[model samples]
Target: MSGMVTSAHAPRRDETERADGSPVTIGALVPLSRPGWAEAGRHLLAGLELAVGEVNDAGGIGGRPLELVVRDTAADPQRAAAAVDELAGLGVAALAGEYHSVVARAAAARADALGLPFLCSSAVIDALTERPTHRVARIAPAQSHGWRTYADFLLGAGHRRIAVAAQPSVYWASGTRILRDHLAARGASIAELDMTEQPATAVCDALAEQGATALLLLVGHPEPAVSIVRSVRQDPRLADVVIGAPAGQPEFAEWAGALGASGAGIPFLRYLPERLGPLGARVGTALRERLGQPPSFVAFEGYDTVAVLAAVLRDHGTDRARVAASWPHVAVEGTRGKIRFSRTPGTGVWQWAWPPVQVVDRDPAEPARFRILHTG
Candidate 1:
């Protein structure tokens, strides 16, 4: 009887618990407005919310469920910094969100100073990961890679004499410069058109006068693209010239028609939200179902950003140190492509960027298709 009591009295097992004996809560800062960011924010929120739900369902972190606290940055760096500061105050294990490069820079510094592992979800500017600051990990590829692909497409097609139209933002300026430099290296003549001062008509006319046969548009806004196309079509000499864009935003289709069908026949690169794998699709569907729409490339970053952070959280168990140390492996298959940060110091910004170059050519009986001109 004593032997039987000893066998039955074996110490009961104890469940694992966190240092504070609490569940992990993550924080996210995203721009819900500022054109092209709202839909993306919703998609990312859905992706994150769904993932968190699943994580909790599987038995929350350290036997405690997960929670997320969210904030909006509005695409302004100052506002983003404030948002980051606010999220930081929540004592979250990790922080995520903020896609604009400038905003990322500020938020990254804040996260680093606070020793928070910052997962930059969708900002594609090369400035985020290029710093020695090393406080941030990105799940988005650099825009330079995309620009390189654009240059290669132009060069391989034997298209010389290129005209570029760009907005004044650093994102556009930097990307344009990268593409321009690459094109020049490959023996392609370039004409830079500053959209700040000159209208699209003036810029197109100038390019036409300069004997430009192909126009490579770098402007993020679709307005300039449509305007340029209208001008080119009006000038019979420039009408048949090859026109290419990095990615035509879907939200601009009506604007494309408003500007005229000339650009409707041209080709542009498009951000494909559906190609980002299961995690991306789930988030995208959630956003559409909940918000009545899907997100753009920027917002897609939000879903990817949250996914990467959640993976880190699952592995590290609420340790900021472990999360930062393991960031190079936080692979996020976003709408663009599989993304993660490079541990190598002083590398260019963006951990992964998979943007496809596409042409928006009009069909006689069908709608415009964003055909893949080349995959970067």
Candidate 2:
């Protein structure tokens, strides 16, 4: 039986076979299908469910089984907001998991308005809530913290002429601005290429005209981004130009499977320590097996999400207000490091402050393997 449950109105026993008939539900928001990055959602869910199974095995939250009331956000802000409403109606103690920043923002806003305590698993937008709220705590690093690190990596790598192939979205726009400000302040230039305004081939032409040494992908996956990469890779004019994705789009296996050698050597941001601790190592092994491949950092984020929530639920009952209030009190040892929350300036929600950040890529010589190029 799956550790996570989908039924909105009933509870089913998972592998735990807990004596208590009642189940504690965490409403999960993930992008499970097209338009959404399904690969990321799968990794996130694997970690959440893996931790859930372990929580159950350890006798659960005071003997009641823990389950995830799953909902697919499908990368839509409106859809994610609706899911937040539906999950609240389902009586979940708290909400968890979401990959896309924009989608998570919508869900976070709605969850806030409804007075639901949400533990965001992933999503790095700085302004998650319009006003400071104790109701939401995040497991992911804020966008500024991670993106600035990525900019430093580019600067250290001798990349001065940077260009971004961008789509129209709040998340992408924020990233472009962050890169532009950080790089420009350090004597570098930043240019924007609108993928929506031009075809992939045309984008290549624009990039070549800009004479950029690095191109940041501030766009979505497998569509214009993939097409742009292929075009740039095949273009002789842009052969020396480096490609980067600060959003970590290339961290998934599907990226390698789809692009093969062409996908290699494009650095991207990821949240993981340079080395995993004992707990992280153990969880990594389990997640690797569960995923049938090496687990991405996102998987660890998912696990930490549940671990924190499980701790909160175990110590403080299932009351919604209590769970939300417990964020500041949390000091659980997570797969990455010790997890805690505080009000980060600018992000209105309670944030983890920072997570280990790495700029990594698939080796051109070994497409299946990853190499860390920079750390933040």
Best of the candidates, TM-score? 2
Off by more than 4 A, model 2: 11-20
* True-vs-predicted CA distance for residue 236, candidate 2, Å: 1.1
Q: Roughly what TM-score does model 2 have, to 2 decimal places?
A: 0.96
RMSD of each: 9.2, 2.9
TM-score of each: 0.78, 0.96
Q: lDDT score of model 1?
A: 0.62
Local accuracy by lDDT, each model: 0.62, 0.89
- Can you write out model 1's per-residue Cα lDDT over 30-116, one digit (the tens) per residue? 666865355455555555665566566666665666666677776777877776666566566777766566677778877777787
| Local accuracy of candidate 2 as per-residue lDDT tens digits, 1-376 | 4465665564322322234557888899989999999999999999999999999988888878888889999999999998888888777888999999989888888998988899998899889887888999899999999999999999999989888889999999998888889889999999888878688898778877888899988888888888888999999999899989888888998888888899999999999999999999999999999999999999999999999999998888888888888989999999999998998998999899778999999999998888999999
The number of residue pairs in model 2 that clash at the backbone is: 0
